[model samples]
Structure formats: structure tokens, C-alpha cells
Target: MKTYRIRKPKIVVIGGGTGLPVILKGLRSESADITAIVTVADDGGSSGTLRSSVNIAPPGDLRNVLVALSDMPQLYEDLFQYRFREEDEFLANHSVGNLIIAALSEMKGSTYDAIRLLSTFMHVEGNIYPASEEPLTLHALFEDGMTVSGESKIAKTRKKINHVYVTNTNNTDKPKAARKVIKAIEEADMIVLGPGSLYTSILPNLMVQEIGEAVSKTEAEVVYICNIMTQKGETEHFSDANHIQVLHQHLKTKFIDTVLVNTEKVPENYMDTKTYDEYLVQVIHDFKGLRDEGCRVISADFLELRNGGVFHDGEKVVEELFRLVFGAKY
Candidate 1:
């Protein structure tokens, strides 16, 4: 007999790239209404290249989120994820997911509608939307007065992001927030952020003014899932406190109430190696720093990676978050 559970609270996860998908996978089991707000500023690889040549929002992050929410039917998901390998060929290195999204966007007359249609086909459990409808180019103005254009270049340069703003500021067709998304935030038991690249994945959505504001006003207790490792160029030497500080700086609100940090220690052998050790992030000891920022920190053993590499155990992370929200560990 099938036992029906009470509908879980809505969850709005804002970010782009690989990290958002992982969180989606874990939370899907909880049956919360999920809404993913993806960054559209990519201009590298398949997504960026397509955005530049085709003049549409990059579909890479949106593709990843769609797949994560998709029911795994073995070949079904595999077929969607497969990328061509041969260089110089027409479809070289482009994800099948990206191609599918791009084609749907063209046919439907808008990227937003296309994703909605694709979600139906994939049978994704939750909703996913790009942060904006009009394509947004990520432009970074460094403190030294030099400006870096494009998400890829800005990500690689070893500079503190002085300021990030979108191009085509005149375009007013901001993607309507999924009605479910705003409702989810308002009704959510909790909201989770990060465990991904700060500037690339986390901050890009916050850079969108409306999205940032929505986060500020939501009644849900906002929980930041801090990244375990620092990106050398982007978040160099950033402690958990610094990460929260950056988000607070950008939003100018008391949005983040609690931070979930990984306190698990990686094996010494794993840390001493070069390639595997490259971006290893350590836990922040500056509890006082976090306290100053008006957020309480919860440290736990939340590290694990299914596809390999260091990542917060999404299922476990969600478990912790759910416990915090409901006031009892599940």
C-alpha cells in the first residue's frame, strides 16, 4: 500500500552550474516543491559559445538543473547528458541537454517557455527558471579600474570581484519569477544556498536585484550551505565567515540566519596530493567573525561526493536542514 506523506515545504534554491543540481537531487526525495533560479551569464564552453553566437541566454546551468530533477530512466537521462567528443565536428563537446534546451527555446519563442515545456517532457519533479528572461552578460569591474567581460574570463582571473553588473540594462523583460517560486519562498520551511563556486554559482543570482530582494523578504529561515573548498582565483583564502560576509554585502539584509558548514577532515594523504588537493577548502575557525555578521554557524560532517571530488553530501545536508527546520532530526 502506498502511504502518502504530508506535502513538504517549498524550497527555492538559487545558483547555477554543477552545485545546484546536487542539492536538487537530495531534496527531491523530501517532496518539497523545488524552484531553481539559474544564472544566465555564462559565455564559455557550450553554453557561453551558444549564447554569444545565438544571442540567447546560456542554457548550460538550466540543463544541469533539469537533469537533476528528472527521473532517472537509465538511458533516458544518459541520452540527455551525453556530449559529443570529436573536435571540429558540428556537435563537438556540446551536451545533448544544451542542444535540446536551445532547440526548444527557438521553437517556443522564449527560453523561459521552452524550459517549462522540457520540464514536462523530462517529468522533472520541481520547477526551474533562468534568473532573467533577457540574456545577461556578466561584466566585472575590478578595483584597479580594468573591466573583465564574460563569465569565463572573470572566473579565471585572480582578482576580488569589485562589482558585477549585467549588460543590456535597458532590456526590461525580466523573467517573471515562477509564481510557484515566490510562493515557495513565502511558505517554505527553509531555503538552502551554496556548496558551490561562490562568484560563478552563488553570487550571480544574488547580483540580480529582484531575486536578491525576494530572498530578503522571505519568511523562511535562510540556510547557507557553505562551500568546502576555495576557488584559487575567485574565493582565495575565504573562510566561511568571509563567504557569508560577501553575500550580506551584496544583499544588504539579514537574509542569512544560519550557516551549515562541513567540519569533517579530509584524509591527510588526500590533502597532500597536488591535483586532488588543488582546491581543498578548510573549515573556518572564526566563529566570532560569523557572530559579528549576525548568523549562527552549525558545523557537521557533511562531506561526500557521488560522482567523485569533494562536495557536501546532498542527502545528508538536506537531512540536517530538514532537522533544523522541523526541530527534530530525521
Candidate 2:
């Protein structure tokens, strides 16, 4: 593990889904003050069910993040992650952590407060914040000008996405970041985006008005860990630069300062498509396009193929992140 002499670099990681936890888990071993701003726009599976019933921000992402950063024993983490068998009608498919989060949200009267309380109990080393105080409905406008609402349904449409925005689920009001979310972005030495879904997981968090504004103005080095694979419903033929382009288009600013791109190739017929169907192909690299967008590209063989799935080697990514952080500081 690498340590900082003066002060630990503050890293604010923004995005949701399975990818956020991967990055957080790696960051746990490094000497860094980490804060994760996870998307709450999910309306699928257990998260969606809880959001509809309890009216709290989706807890699935938050739960995963908590587990990722927790210093608790493996058994405790396993217990929190345990999901009920589908045979149990009332508790079917609900993770224990999600249920706990729901109960806490009800007891505390807000999801944000519930998470803060849970952080203490879970022994999470860093901050884990829901992107918004209220549940948000993600709306995507496709290239064909068709607008689709709900994160769960957007990809199902298989339409080309033009842009996406969020709205407070309960009213017409704009969705606001949970307290301190913007402050984390402002104070961060570096802001890391993605290794997750472009439209659903990553963009939804940035779509929060204040969060987007803060990112646009923050002096921190904004780094995008471009996805290893183009998503089926989202970025079917997208190059690495296309991913960056979408982010810039959504925020209406060229805020990203650096991009991490994977150069290693996935061996032919290595991925099990049946298990990981959302991914289409390796994200085509467009170095010129990335340079055109004014981003400093860091290309490497940061690949981790596990159980026939392609993922970012978290430790490798963290090594590069530390180099960037210390390089910028010194």
C-alpha cells in the first residue's frame, strides 16, 4: 500500500452499478481520502421495488459501496449481502443490506441520514453518499428523438441515446445532491468517473443540477476511466472518445482532464455472453478524438478477465490514480 507524507489525496468517485464498488474496494488499500457519489436513479430489481414501496433513494448501489469500503469481517459483509431465496414470497430476492437500508430510511425519515448512520455501524473508511436526497427518475432522449423514462427501461428500448436528464420522482422540482456531495467534488484532488454504464450508471449522477455545476467549475483533475466494452443498448459502436464525447455533451463542458484507456485485447471467444449480455464489443480506441476533446490520455493494459467477464483491474487502476495524484501534487 502506498502512503502519502503530507496529506492523503482526496478522491471523489462518481458513478453507480457494480463498477463503483470495484474502484472503492481497491482504493481502500491505498492511503487516500475517498468519497463515492453513487447514482440513485436505479429503478430495477430489489432497488426498484424498495424505491416504489418505501419511497427512498435506491439502496443497492449504496449497500455495495458500503460493503466495498467496510473494514468489517468477511462474515459480516456476507451476512449483509445475503439475499433471500425466491421461494420466500415476502422477502424474495431482497438483500439483507437493502432491507436494513429501507428500515433505516423509514426510521431516520431520510435516506441520507440513514446512510450516515449506517456508515458508522459498517465501519466504512470513507464517505458513501447517494447522489440525490430524493429518488430520481432518469429520462433519456434517443437520437430518434424518443424520450424514455426510468433507468431500468432505457436500455430495454435499445435506442441510441442522445442525452439523459433526471427529475425528482415526487414532483416537478429539480433533483438536488445529498448534502456535501458538491463539496466533495469541489475539494477533491481528483474526480474519477466511470468504468460503468454511460447512460444509466454514470450520467444519472452528473445529471443532478448542482453536482453537474460543481464538476464543471471544480479545479480538480477530472479523470474518466473509460469502459472496457461498449454496452449493447447504450454504446454499441462507441469508441473511447465517443464515451468522453457523451459525457461532455451531457455536462455541456469539456470538464474531463484525463482519461484512462485499456489497450489490452480480450482474447477471441473468451467472454461468456450468456452471463454478461449487456456488453457488446471492446470499446474502439480513438486517441485523436480524445486529444481533440482536450483530454490527456493514459493508455495501459489495465485488464482483468475474471469468470469470463472483462473488468478494470482495480489495483492497476489505483496505481495509476496514485501516480496522477502525486504527480499533480509534486
Candidate 3:
């Protein structure tokens, strides 16, 4: 029998929030090696509550990432994602996975270590890393020259977001990326950012000094999966180009080589306001501006309407990604 060396393309995805996991789950079905670098600046709900009392980095995003990559059965994954209802008092709105990660963090001495242990035990198909080992506070500078701090708070205030950055909760100390994160980026064949909230979820991870620098300097094909809808607080009327511009401004470079955009029309008055109210409008497109920033745009009807809400078609998105990775003559 002849053994052939099959090199799986190393794909590193950097972002947090619910969107990251959708793409990860789709990618899990493909033949690429994946590494997810998740943001730790989540200051909302179970994550925020835990961060406030325990001083561990919020485990919400990390928990979701671990579950997405896990090859475990649906029942186990559901158990991990189970959340206590509002009437539960002390445990109200807390996810079972968040509690598990918190307990593991306490046992192992750090959130990064806890994630690694959980990843192994869950038989996670890919590596999931927290952007920073320590808890971080997100500070956003609004257009009015006023700065608001905290991820949850920023989302509630409908201010014109000037820019956002992250700071270690330990005063002036700068946060550092784990060694594995840097290595993964350095060795990646393709690096993907977003499909998540631009400022809150995606930028938080890139703001980490070393990780940002590594992404800026990496030789891989950097693809950005632009969000399908405009968010109210952070990006109310942002064009697709505006989103890319903001990312470029934050990273201090036009590192994006390709942009995947959704061209499907969202039916007017379709999204249920009471449930998915955070979404404001469909993102407008500016192909010229995207080209000006030196990006090859690949626009498609990547929409999936379910539960009267807007979402990226994960299977379609994965198809495009596969074409880029395996078929592109780059």
C-alpha cells in the first residue's frame, strides 16, 4: 500500500458572536484544517455576569465555538447550549456550556487552558482559541467625541461609532495572544474574518497587538465574509464598502484580498422586529469602493430566511469558500 501525503489547507477564522459558529459548522463538513480565534470582550448576559464576578474571560463565544467544532452527538451539543430560563433566579439566562467552561477555567487556572481541555474532551474537530487569555473591556469612541466602554453597553447606545478598541481589565496592561494563535495565523493557507458584528465581535480579536500584527503581515489569502445586514448601534447604514473601510482603518492596512457579499434581496417588512430587532437594514453595496480597496468581489445570493429573520446561507457560503480555496488560481 502506498501512503500519499494529503495536506489539508490550514484555514484560520478570527471573530466571535453567533455568526462565527454558523460558518464554522459549515466548514466542519469540508476537508480543511480550521482554527477559530474567538473574541473575549463579550460583556453581556451570562458572559458578562460571569466575567463580573469570577474575573475569567467571558466564556459565551468560546463555548459556542467549541460546540460548533465538536464532532459529538446532537444531544451532547444541545446539553452544552442549554440555557436556564429567566425565572431561574441565580442561574437565569446562563448557558450550561458557559458554566462548564467557567468551572474548568477555575480548575485549570486560565480560560485558554480550559478551552483546550474542553476542546479535547468534546472531540472538537478544530482548535478554538480565545483572542486573549485575560478578560478585556471594549471601549468605543462615538462620533460626538464621547467614549463608551463595554460590549453590551455599546450595542444599546445608538451612537455613531467612531472606532472601537480593546483594553485589558488589569488597568494599563496590554493583552497578549496565545502562542498557538500566532502560529496558526503564520502557517495558515487562508485567513477569514467576520460574518459577525464588525466592531464588537470581529475587531475585538484583531485589536490584540500580536494577532493584529500577524494578520497584517501574513502571506495568506485574507477573505472577509461581510455581514448580510446592517446593525443598528454600530453600523446603522453602513455600505458593504463602509464595512471594509472600517476594517481597513482599524487594521491600518488594506489586507483583505477578497470579499464575499450577499446579493439576494430581503423581502420588505419580513424580519420580525420583536425577535430580531437588532438588525436595521440590508447592507448597501459599493463594488467600486471595494475594488478601490484592492479586493476581488464575489457577490452571490447568500441569503437564508428562517424564523422571519435574515441569515447567511451557510452551505452556499461554504461552497464559495471552497471554490476560493481549492479552485482559485492564486
Candidate 4:
């Protein structure tokens, strides 16, 4: 039988944390080529414990991304995400997937290889690349001359963040992306930046030397997904424009070609603070500032409240991303 091959649009999605998986799940439903470049600077919770013990690239975010794009059964995915709550001392609250990634990383000699192997085993629909092959440490410089050495500690300070950068954990050297990550950006039709923490999750990937430079110089249309609400410690009282401005300042260039902002009003006292305590307030709008920086702002009712938390509607955001990708060709 003569078979026809499909040509999927090359889409490069960046960032990590809880946000990347939401969008990835949306994109998984579409017939498109996706390459998720994830942040490896995570230093909290289960990821932190693993990183501190075995020196693997914190696998929590990557694990979530892997499951998000996997076509496996729900049982398998759940098992991978399942955390140990038993009386096991070393494995308390650690995920099965994280341990698997750590094991593969040690066996394969790098995180890149481990992820590639897992992707194939999971029958993942898209590519997942770590921002760098080696484990990275995130360092943030605050506006008041305070510097935080880890991603976990940066937000706790609740101080004004000036800029953030990453270095390979074993040596004092500038971190660089794998060649695959660079090629993915160079060839992508569209590059999506956010829906994650500004300072901790998103910028860490861009701060890598080659990856940031590629993002700045790539001809692809770069899009930023504005968060629905301000984070307590990282982005307290930040406006939509403030988020984009911070990215511009860090990259030292106006790389974002477009921004997706939520316009729907968050009802007062609608969110249960006890359930979702990380959120502070709705992000204020600054349309003038967004336009001044040459961003094509597309605002809509992108807000969706579920599980007592406010989030960007992945379906709506993906629809806008498709529109921008189609426009970029013309």
C-alpha cells in the first residue's frame, strides 16, 4: 500500500512548572509537531530531594510533560505520577516517574538520553528536550542587591527580582542548550514562552546562553502566554505588561512577537484561598505598555476556574497560537 506522510507544523513550546503540561495536553489533541524545551532549574519538593541526592536534572517537570504527551493508558500515567506516602524514609512523597528518570539518567550518562529513551517507551507524540543536558542551578539577583542561589529560595524571599541565570552544577561555567534544542528553535514555525512562573520556570530556559540567543535571533513568531493571576512571591501585583517587560529585560531584546492576555474578570472571593494559596491577585492590564514594546496583544476570555484555581484555558490559548502560526506564514 502506498502511504501518504503527514507534515505537522513545527511548534516549539518552552517553560516548565505546572503550566507547560496543561498546554501540552491541549496540543497533544492537535496534529502538529511539538518540541517542549523544559526548565531544569527546579529545586523544590520531590525534585529537590532527588537533585540533592543523586545529581539528576530535577525530573518532576519533565515527568509531568512526558505523561501529558503520552498515549499510554490512564493507569500507567497514574502509576508514574503516584507519590509514595508510606513509611519509607527515602522515598517519601517521591514520584515513580522521577525515580525512573533518575535511574535512566545515571545509566545513560545524561538527562537528554534518559528523556529520549523514556519518550520512545511511552510512545510520546512530541519531542521533550531538557533546557540543558547537565543539571543546572538557578541563581537570581534581586533589585536590593540580594542574590538567591536556588529556584526554591528565590520566591521565598518575596523581594524584587532583577535577573536570573543558570550555571552547570558541577562547574562554574555558562550553561548551553543541546544542539537539538537549538535546531528545534531554529526550525520551529512558532515559539511559545509562558503560562508558567516568570522568574523561576520560564526565564531559566531562556537564560541559557545559546537558547536565549536563538530565541532572540530566530525568525519564528515568539508568543508569550500571560498568566491569569499574580504569584504570591515571584510576581506579586504584576501587570500583564510587567511580565513581558521582565522577559525583554532578561533577553535584552524585544523577542516576543505576540502576547495572549486574559480579559475575563475574576469574580471577587470566588477562589478558595485555602485550596489555592499560591495565587495573590488578578494581573492588572497595561495595554499601552504592551503596544509600546511592539507586541501584538490579543486579549480574550482565556480564564478558566477549576479545582479552586484560576488558569488559562488551554484550548483557547492553543486556538490563538494556531492563528498566529497561520499568520506567520503570510
Candidate 5:
């Protein structure tokens, strides 16, 4: 057994879906305390179905994060991830995990309580909190006077996301911070935002009024991990600085102390063969230019994922993050 060492720095991660979980898996080794603030605006597929028909918090993203942090064997994780395959009945497309969470919420009398119960069963290494307690919606306002609601739709539209807000702007049921989550942030030596989708995975948590305000006021050194490639439509031609610019525009405050960018380039051969190759994006990341704007851009070896997809090397990325946090001169 690889004995888990405990660095236990209070680390608060704000995002939703696959990206945050991958980061959690890497950071687990650093012994830093971890908290995940996940977005709950999903309104598509099994998540949307449950939300519309059953009036429960969307469970897909939350389930993914839970599985990511779990110490349970792959069998249980597979069961949690199993989606209906045979196309016949009411449960056809829904995930078993989503139903389990919904059922647990009903039994426990609250979604938050149900999550705690489920996490305990899974032996999740860290805490996960929804941005808000209520069954809420995401509203997207595009520059063309068009409006879209729900996380799924906005994600698919391929349009420039102008701004976002919760549907019930007046609702104030900030999900009580998981005791450990707040403590993680308060004590975290560093907090990282991204390598995730800009609008969907990254900004959704930040859109929450209370969470955003708290992040702005927190003293942890904030780092924005810039994505290596841009998402089509949302961040076409966007550079490292462009990503931070969009974030600052949305938040209306400057909370980011540093931005980490990939200094290495993708292998030309691989880039030429990927699907949608022409649309392959590169960072307009100029360190001097970012330094001029008063944001320090830390360059690292952020490379394309091995075996095909475009993503950062998880171990390498997190290792660099460790160095940056502990003030390694690298």
C-alpha cells in the first residue's frame, strides 16, 4: 500500500464535472485538505429528466466527483456509473448513481444530507458541496439578445457566452458550506481553478453570488490553470490571457494572484491528425504581455494527454502546482 502522506493544507476547488475530479485525484497525494464546490445547473439527459420529472437536484456532476474521490473498488464505482443500456423502460437512459442519489435525498430529507451519506459509503477523500441548496437553473444571456436556460443547452449552442446568472436571483439558500470545505479554503496554502471548461466547468461555481464573494475575500493564493486547447464556439482563438480576461469580466473583481500556462507545444504530428484538426486551438499566452497586465503567468510543461485527447499531464500538472504552492524556484 502506498501510505498516504498528510500535507493537509486547506485546498478549495471550485468547478463541476470531470475536470475537478481529476485534479482531486492528483492532489490526494499532497496531503492537502480538499473541498469541491460543484455546479448544479444541469438540465439535460438523466440529470435534466430527474430535475423536470422528479424535482430533485441534478446528480450527474456530483456523482462523477464522488466517484473520483472514492476509495471503493472499481466494481462499486462501475455500479454507480452504470447507465441503462437496453432501450425499453422508464429507466432506459438514466444512470444508476443519479437514481441512488435522488432516492437518498428523499430518504435523508435533503440533498446535502444525502450527499454526506453517500460519500461516507464511498469513503470519499474530501468534501463536495453544491453551490446552492435549491433545485436551481442557469440562465445564459448571449450578446445577440438571445437567452438560454439550463447548463446543457448553453454548452451545446456554440455561441459566445456573454453572461450568466441563476434563474432565481433573489433566492438565497447558499448551501451551508461543508465544515471541512470552508476550513480547507481558510487553511489552504493555495487554490486552483481549472484546467476545465471555461464557462461550464469553471465559472458555474464562481457565478454563485455567495461563493464568488467568499473567493474574492479569501486570502489563499489563487491560481488559474489555463486550458491548453480552446473549446469550440465558447473560446475560439482565446489565449491564456483571454481566459483570465473572461473570468475577471464575469466576476467583477480581481481575485486571481497567478495564472499557470503551458509553455510546451503539442507534437505537430498528433495535432495534425485529431478530429476537428483545423479548429485545434493554441494559447496566445505571452508571458510578458500578461505580466504587463499585472497578472503573473507561470509557465510549465502542460502537454497533451497521452493516447489521443488534448489535456494536461495530470501528474506533471499537479507536481508543478505543488512546486508553485511551496515556493519552488522551478
Candidate 6:
């Protein structure tokens, strides 16, 4: 007698910053074949320094995502995430993992190859692909017609972002997806966008022309994990629908099939502004607007407040995602 074995669901998560790893960590516990497509446009802090000095794709986001998906020991993860003290002249503020990735990129001749090799060393349970093989520069055109060139500097403009795009930092060539990025999207059973920054973290990845095109053409159910709070310089006063609108306008397609929104109220005066100053208020709901934009809304209490900061409860979000995937499969 022949027996049939069920295949694991393929989930491709696209985004960067701190939020992508949160979702990835939760998905690591699930029965899914995960692929994390991380943005390489970051130009801030340790990442910016490395990108400028080594001319490599920013490793901070990729490093975090790698740790999230890896089965490495807690001590090893801690060491990788450790940052040098500010007093240190040469090594100040650089993470150990970023340095390792930079060194590996130099050794392998490319960031793409470095991450693939590191994934094996780290025992990463899933695929981690940089949005582009080379470093990308995020350009944000603000409402005032002025444009900002770097991801870290965009928010400092304090002006409304009209739109965002990416460019290859190497030369005049167009930014393209790292190899197999489009293939991952094409084969995915589900594509998760983000609970990250709207313009800087998420849009940077989608702005890659080939990636944007593949996402628009994919048959997978594209789900966006909506932000729990509005970002001060990015999406202040923006409703949940506004976020989706920005994504759709960037891609030139209503590609998102579903959105998971956090309807639970964040308690007033509960945020620790000193630590999480970028986040403003709770993201306002616009179910009608979401529907108007052709998105199936899944509103729930996906909020997880920690140390006075609000974020998505990844496990709950992943559970909903699996339900959606299996629901369609059956």
C-alpha cells in the first residue's frame, strides 16, 4: 500500500528592521517551509557604517533574521547580537554578527553567497535571502517635492513621504532581486509582508523592480501583518488602510489578498517614549477603507506589549496565517 505524506506549507516573509525577525521567530515553531526576503537598504547605525566601509549589503537586518531562524544555542545568539561599548574607539557600536557577515561577504565575494554559507554554519531552519545581492539605497520623495537618499535619514525629514524606491548602490544598474527570490515568491503558498516600518523597511524590498513584479504576478495569498502603532515620521495620522494603500500604489497592483489588523486598544500613556520614540499612537482602524482597497480584513488582538512598547504577537499572527493557508488548501 502506498501512503501519502503531507508537504509543509511554503511561507515567504518580506520585510526588514526589527519586526521581520519577530515574525520569523514565531514561524520557526510552525510546520512551514519559511523563506525570509530581507531588505538590504538600511543605512543606519552599525549597518550604515559597514555598508559605507566595506561596501557590502547592510547585515543588521539579515543578521537578526538569521538568528531568528537558526537553531543555534542561546549563548551563541547572544554573542552574535552583542554590540561593542560606545567607549571603544575602533569597534564601538558594531554587532559581532554584522562583522562576521561582512567578513564572510568579503571572503565569498558577495553578500548573497556569504549568507547562504552562514545559514549552513548557523543551522538556519529556513531560507534567508537579501532583497538584492548588493547594497540598495532607499530614496524617499516627500510631499514637499524634496527627496531623501538614505533609509535612516528619511524619517528625520519629518515630512510626509510621497513614495519610496530603491536603487543599486554599486552603479547605474537597476536593483534586482537576489537569485531565487522571485522563485521563492512564485512557489510560496503564502506571502507575509510586515509589521515593520511602512516606507523604510517594507517598501524598500518591494521597490526592487523584479521583486515587485513577481509579487504582483504570484498566485500565493499575500497577507500583510499590519502595524500595531503608527510611526511618528513615517505613518503618523495614517489609518491601517493608508498603509495598504501605500503598498498597492508602490506595486501598482492590489496584490494583498488579506490583512491581519490588531484591533485591541493600546492603553493610553503606556508607551516608553524614551526607548521607542518612533512609534506614535495606535494605528487607527479603517475596515471600510481596507475593503475598498480590496483586502480581506482579519481584525484581532494581535498586540503584545513588552517593556512599554507595542508589537505583534507573532505566534498568534502565525496561527492565523496557517489557518488561512490550510483553509484554502482543504
Best by TM-score: 2
| Candidate 6 to truth, TM | 0.98
Residue lDDT tens for model 4, 151-255: 999888988888998989877777889649999999999999989999999999999989999999999999999999899779998999999999999999999
Q: Cα miss at 137, model 3 (Å)?
A: 0.7
Model 5, 1-330: lDDT tens digits are 233444445667777756677777877756656777777777778988886766667888899889877889999889999999767489988889999998987788666788889989899988887766666677778888788877778856777778876754235555343334455566667778887878777777777666676677777778888888777656777878778778888888777888888888776656534554423566777676566556777787877565555666667777777777667221
Per-residue CA lDDT of model 3 for 156-178, tens digit only, reads 88999888999998668888997
All-Cα superposition RMSD per candidate: 3.0, 1.0, 2.4, 2.5, 3.4, 2.6
Q: Which pairs of residues collide in model 1?
A: 43-48, 44-48
**lDDT of candidate 3?**
0.90
Off-target runs (Cα >4 Å) in candidate 4 are: 1-6
User: Number of clashing residue pairs in every model?
Assistant: 2, 0, 0, 0, 3, 0
List ranges where model 5 is wrong by over 4 Å: 1-7, 86-88, 169-184, 268-280, 304-307, 328-330
What is the per-residue lDDT of model 1 for residues 153-266, given as tens digits with 9 covering 90 to 100? Answer: 886777777767665432645534433456656666677787677777777777766667778887777889888877766777888898888888778776898988888876
- What shift in Å separates residue 328 of candidate 1 from its native position after superposition? 10
- How well does each candidate superpose onto the true structure, as a TM-score? 0.90, 0.98, 0.96, 0.96, 0.87, 0.98
Q: For candidate 2, lDDT tens digit of each residue in 1-330? A: 556567889999999998888988899998999999999999999999999999999999999999999999999999999999999998999999999999999999999999999999989999989999899999999989999999999999998988999999989887888999988998999999987999999999999989999999988889999999988889999999999999999899899999999999999899999999998889999999999999999999999999999999999999999899889865
Which residue pairs in candidate 5 have backbone atoms (N, alpha carbon, C) closer than 3 angstroms, thus clashing?
A: 7-31, 8-31, 10-188
Cα lDDT listed for each candidate: 0.76, 0.93, 0.90, 0.90, 0.74, 0.93
For TM-score, candidate 1 versus 3, the one ahead is 3
- Misplaced by over 4 Å in model 3 are 1-5, 328-330
Q: List the residue pairs that clash in candidate 2.
A: none
- C-alpha RMSD (angstroms) for model 6: 2.6
